[model samples]
Target chain A: MISLNLVLFISSLMFFIGVAGVLIRRNLLIILMSIELMLNAANLNLIAFARQSGTVDGQAFALLVMGFAAAEVAVGLALAVALYRRKDTVQADDINLLNG
Target chain B: MNALFTSIGHNLFLVFGLLACAGAAVMILSTSAVHSVLGFLFSMIMVAACFLCLSAEFLGMAQLLVYAGGIVVLFLFVVMLVELTKYKEKSLFTTQIKWSFPLVLIALGIFAYTMKSNLFDAATPVALSLSSGLAEGLSVSAQNAQMVSRGLFAGFLLPLEILSVILLVALVGALVLAKSERVS
Candidate 1:
């Protein structure tokens, strides 16, 4: 059998990729997509550990995170749409209305 | 033949891992918003496969239903609502890549160092076997809906209900936020 560290490596690599996208990309939609990638990476880690522990706790929590992600996407898209309506653009730098 | 059969799980794991990462990369690098949404869907399905490999059947299906089906549709709707043609002319990546790449590399290095030790050290020899053993104890074995529901209702009832409330709030908030002002 292959070692579990490989799974961990996959999780971390995906997480860092998500982080890079969030930090380096200028489009808010891609940023949101990157956030989803990060969430999936965390979910993978949970399922892996749940597999190791023989308990369904991590799976349950993963389900919770999925629900939360759905909620977040809904509201985030709403905000994105609102921003587009007002500003006519979704670029991250163009969105400085909240700057104090 | 025996070796191939035995190593199937690991091979499948590697395939899904690569697919997921490639999808993420596509989403990050894609110039168009629609392409990014498609990439996210691809990565999410690969993640579901990984979950199934780990024997979390219910979560895997849940991931497919909620993510691949629901969230991507929402993203597509927004992509349609927004005017993205202007963005087509601009570069996808910004100036931050000069510094963020090194930061991500260092973070990856730290993660690799910390998780160098193996995680499948449980008394359970194989994840599929453990899940199957637990499954056999229950009436329904192949599908793990029962196991997931048991954990959800018996132990996590409050959180589940709270999540329902949060979804309700999100729905209402989306409606309120997206509602166009109409004046007679």
Candidate 2:
């Protein structure tokens, strides 16, 4: 049998990868993608546990997460575009307009 | 015989896991915004395949359609519209990579030790509540989907409704944010 631990390990690994991405990448878009990776890692954990516990609740939540992620991408990209329009740049460090 | 089956399943899981990890690494490390989006696509598809392995067929399909289809296209459009290609070479990564990588390694090490200790030892034989609802004529995916919807409409109705409102707000917020201010 495929142990749930292995699945959880993979999820944990992916989560850290996302953390690294968010910390290391300068691009706002890639940071958003990393955030998606982290969310996906969490969803993987939820689905894995749901399967183990014999419940459909986790699956439903995962579906909701997908919806939430889609909405997030829509708004996030729009903001990125607007920021680029204002600043002529998408580099996270350069967009310091809000730094007071 | 059971050993053979278990080995096959284990290998399949490893395959998808490796694909996801590799894609995530590529997404994180790539310089160009378009390349990162492509990497994100690969990672999302691999993650969806992992969901399929977990028997979350409905979620897997939704991940493919919503993520790979919708979110990726949005990212692509913004990447193209912003023309992030020009800034790719100037600032691909932050100065924090040197420290962040080591910190991540420590965190992963801690997680692996916890896993080895079996802190999540909930290995009781799963007694499924929805198994009785499965009909003979329906496929497994169909049965899973039915159970998911049943749960969604019953136990998760409020959250589903809330999600619709959230999507609506996001739509309007995107419009307002992206719209240029008209000067008199």
Candidate 3:
């Protein structure tokens, strides 16, 4: 069996990579993808812990998270469509209408 | 020899973990939205393999089916729906990289520190053994899917119901958001 620490390290790295992508990427779609990456990273950690503790509770939570991610992606894509219709662009910087 | 197979099994986790990270990197670095979606698909599939490596067979299959099968297809559909050709020539990254890079680096440092510390001292490795008391005469070798189902339906029933409601709400909201305004 793999060390739990190694799994934690990998998940953390993936989470940070997702954060960097969300921060640096201009496209809204890419940002959404980055969010998915972060969610997957969390799921990785949950499964690793589930294995460590020899319980399926973490797996259950991970399943819920997967469902939540699906919902998130659906709403996000819909919003992206709405934004494209109104603004004719999907770049994150262009959606500054709320800027004071 | 059996030892060779065991060593391979032990190393598979590291291999899949690194591959998943590499796929994430590719997703972030790719300029084309389609390519980025492909990269995300690759990363998710790799993560599912990692789940299998950890013996979470059901979760691994669910990850493959839900993420790689459903979510990636949804992303691809959206990518096709949007007018992406116009933005193809523009720069992919924003101007905030200088700030965000440092922030991410700091976060990485903090994560490394936490990992190096004894924060996870309690999480010693344990074999993947299901709780036999979940059901009468539940064998130790019960299928992973069966065990996960017991966990979800028995232990997390309320949360699962709440999740179903959330999914319903998201479906309605997405429909409302995506509906084209009818011409008056």
Selected candidate, larger DockQ, 1 vs 2: 2
Tens digits of lDDT, candidate 3, B18-38: 999999999999988899999
TM accuracy, model 3: 0.94
Write one digit per residue (lDDT tens) for candidate 1, span B1-184. 9898778755888789889999999999887788899999999999999988877888889999999999999899888888788777777788888899999999898777666643435344233222454455675446567877766776689999999999999999998988876777
RMSD of every candidate to native, in Å, equals 3.2, 3.2, 2.1
Tens digits of lDDT, candidate 2, B56-110: 8888898898899888888888877888657745857888878988999998899
Instruction: Indicate whether candidate 2 or candidate 3 has the larger lDDT.
Output: 3
Which consecutive 10 residues in model 3 chain B have the weakest lDDT in total? B133-142
Say which prediction, candidate 1 or candidate 2, comes out ahead on lDDT: 2
Q: How well does chain B match by TM-score in each candidate?
A: 0.83, 0.83, 0.89
The list of candidate 1 runs beyond 4 A from truth reads B1-10, B117-137
Per-residue lDDT value at A16 in model 2: 93
Q: Taking the tens digit of each residue's C-alpha lDDT, what string does model 2 give over A1-100?
A: 5578878888998999999999998888889999999999999999988888877788888888888988998899889989988888888899777899
Backbone clash numbers for all candidates listed: 0, 0, 0
Q: Which is superior by DockQ, 2 or 3?
A: 3
When only the first chain is scored, the TM-scores of the models are 0.94, 0.96, 0.98
- DockQ values per model: 0.64, 0.74, 0.78
How many clashes in candidate 3?
0
Q: How much is B47 displaced in model 1, in angstroms?
A: 0.9
Worst 10 residues of 2 chain B by lDDT: B127-136
**lDDT winner among the candidates?**
3
